[model samples]
Target: MPAMDTVVPPEGTILTERRGTLLLIGINRPAKRNGFTPRMYKELAEAYTLLDDDPDLRAGVLHAHGPHFTAGLDLPAMAPLMQRGEKAIPPGSVEPTDLGTPGYRRRGKPLVCAVQGITFTLGIELMLAADCVVAADDCRFSQLEVKRGIMATGGATLRMAERAGLGSALLYLLTGDEFGSAEALRLNFVQKVVPAGEQLAEAIRIAERIAAQAPLAVVATRLNALKAVEEGPLRAMGEFLAVQQRLSSSEDAAEGVRSFVEKRAARFTGR
Candidate 1:
């Protein structure tokens, strides 16, 4: 495993680190169980933008510095922002939550999340938006917006029903009850569950494996999958065929074929 050198953020809300082609983004407010103040939301949005804009970064692992992934929104601090209809991402930053305005956009690259301890409200939504999730066996998740006297506005209402069946999603959303990692996996909310303290390592391993593949191919695969979910399967298939045609002529595609024939590891340049 490559050691990560934490890069201090100016806002003191998030920590960033580079691991070869993988970017590590951590929620830094351990004392608050990594809760998102308005400032932390902006910092996290910037980090997501950075991951997308840098071609050198192929994947990202979003975890936290403390025992918990996040306590979700800091209601008192965020209430004012919500009233003003302000989103977590600023004007130019990428929206990781995918809950911004109509023009909001997310990075094209893959994101893997590692969750432990308490993960509530927006924390659950974040995992829904990510490509893959690795949760600690000790992790407890809740979409507690109803309990807080607010509906889940952080993409949970929209995504949870799709990821977890409508009946299952409503069961938890309506009650605002906590669920265990096993339930999360069964609901298809998270892909893997590991022992406590091992979630980050497992997440990083998945990210590294993704980064090792051809970057363009990875992006195309992700886009196709997302498109299928967003647009109906019929429309997504059309887009998928178009993308396949374009990638077939790329330099990386040629290298992929040659390497297969030569029986050696393929080197992709994302061209």
Candidate 2:
């Protein structure tokens, strides 16, 4: 984490703060079990946009204010909007789901998520979209949209199989079976499992580690890996030499070499 910078507090269903180069976005609708009402969905997408567009923000952490990360989308509130064929977000804004389509823009920056208690449906998709996830031991996860007579409209169907394999993804996703944090780890849904109350801190620590690295390299690394996953190995492999040459020519690369010879810490300026 960069040094704490006092940021003007955000007032909405989503709470955002700028701390150094990291953006902390928290779900604030705890009273309603942090459900994604249409308002909350739009606010979160705006926060994601801020993280992507602001050069100062290198990464982001998504957590919740209450005991649980979320109980999933407030279907009654969101169904009407979906029925009307309207996006909850305004025009020219990034959609939170990051589902590749004509209007939805993919996010370039990295995001880490922390979860505990009940995390269902959209909550699972949010984690699937994030770069990493820290799950508390108390978490109880489920994909309950099927039970509600709907299906996951987020990235779950597309990405879950990538992480957990097709059989495992269908095992729970099709059955709406609830699983614990340990199971989440075994399924590769979450990277780390911490005790209750430590999830957000663990996610912040991981984000801080990401922020301390060379910014351009970090972004390129993420993009390249995403390309391998989304596009294919051949597509990502074709650009390897080009990307390496570009990074080697950067000022940060020179500083990295100099710091190694001097036996000191490298100070990266995101150059």
Candidate 3:
């Protein structure tokens, strides 16, 4: 892992650092269990925007500074913002949750998350938005917005069911009960579960592996999978064929074939 001093987040709420082609974004308010303040939301959005815009950044890993991934939203502070219909990304920032203003969307690049201890409401939603997730064996997750007398507006209602199935999602979301990492894994909400202290390291390993692949191929794969989820499979299939045809003629594709025949590692320039 790169030292934390490499890149400092403009808003002190989040920490940003570059580890080779991977961007590490850590929720920095550990004293509050990394709870999301309004400022933190904007900081996170900015981080996602940077990851998407930077061609050199191939992947991103999101983790927290303390024992917990997050305790979820700071309801006392967020209630007013919600009531006033305030945007979370601020002006000129990409929306990480894809819930900002009309036409705002999540970044095209892939994101991986590491979760531990308490992960509630928006925390779970954030993981759902990520392409891959690593959770500590002791981690606890909940979508408790119903208990708070509010609905989950951070894409949980739409995403949780897609990940955990309709019956399981309602069993947890409707009751606001907590689930463990084992359950999360069974529900396909997370890709890996490790020992408590090893979650971040495992997540970083996964991100590094992703970053080593041909960047254009990785991005196209992510986009194709996302399209299958957002649009119907039939439409996504058509789009996938078109993308494959276009990518097959790229320099990276030629390099990949040449490297395979030569029995050497490929050095792709993402063309």
Candidate 4:
């Protein structure tokens, strides 16, 4: 495993390894209900970059080691930073980029999260970037920045609208109201809802399935799907074909073909 950044306070978070295929990121601030300090986001950004570059890791699972996933940003940590200027964040801070992009972008593999209790503002934004999410049935979801005297800047207006459609997305964005996990599932914001304690295990089962698939193919498919929604379909299709041409020439492609002909599971080497 790579050396994770030291920015993360040892008390607030923990990263546990699972078979070298699944990564478990746990928010440990139960006293704060896992509310994030600026340092935590900086640590998260660095951790994400580390995971992005790891060849052996096939999937990541974000879960909290507490009753709540996150209570949103730490107000005390954010207030001083905001007082400086919108863009005047301290070095290594992961406050939302004023430039309208998410703080860190993961290119390959999938991110699956298990959310429970409350997830507000930036929590919801992080979930938007995830490929799949499993929430406890009692999870409370919200976009509370508007009521907090600021607009949601963590890609909520753009990505949330795309995930939940204009009307449903607007309902939460406009009113800053709380919705249950059922509503999140109905709006297609989350993939599944399990009983409270089952979320992490369920997410791991899903991530393991994702890990078993052909890695390069998974990357190509996700890239195309994200592009189709954000960029034009033509551009997405063009990129898809370009990726296909390269992947088709890979060793994993050969293994898949051979495995199919042999009538067995493909032992994809992710070549």
Give me the candidate number with maximum TM-score.
1
lDDT of 4 by residue, 1-271 (tens): 2234446553365455555677776666777777877666665655555556788888888777667888888877777776775432334332232122344344466878889999988788787777899999979998988788888766789877887789889999999999999999998889999999899889888988998988888888887887798777988977766788899999999999999999999898789
Better of 3 and 4 by TM-score: 3
Give the per-residue lDDT digits (tens) of candidate 3, residues 1-271.
Answer: 3334444343338779988898999887767777888899988998999999998898999998778889998878678989998866767667777544565656778889999999998899899889899999999899998998999888888888988789988999899999999999999999999999999899999998888888888988887887788787887798867798988989999999999999998988878
Residue by residue across 1-271, what tens digits does model 1's lDDT show? 2332365343348778999999999888767777788889888988999999998999999998778889898888789988898776668678878554576666789999999999999899888889999999999999998888888987898888998889999999999999999999999999999999899999999999999888999999998888888877987888866798999999999999999999999999899
Collision count of model 1: 0
What is the Å distance of residue 111 in model 4 from its true position? 0.5
Ranking of predictions according to lDDT: 1, 2, 3, 4
Q: How close is candidate 3 to the true structure, as a TM-score?
A: 0.93
- The list of candidate 4 runs beyond 4 A from truth reads 1-11, 85-106
Provide the overall lDDT of each model, using Cα atoms, as 2-decimal numbers: 0.87, 0.87, 0.86, 0.76
- Runs with alpha carbons beyond 4 Å of true place in candidate 3: 1-12, 99-101
Error of 2 at 47 (Å): 0.8
What TM-score, over all chains together, does every model reach?
A: 0.95, 0.93, 0.93, 0.88
Q: Which stretch of 10 consecutive residues in model 4 shows the poorest summed lDDT?
A: 92-101
Global local distance difference test of model 2: 0.87
Best by lDDT: 1
Candidate order (TM-score): 1, 3, 2, 4
Kindly report which residue pairs in candidate 1 clash with one another. Answer: none
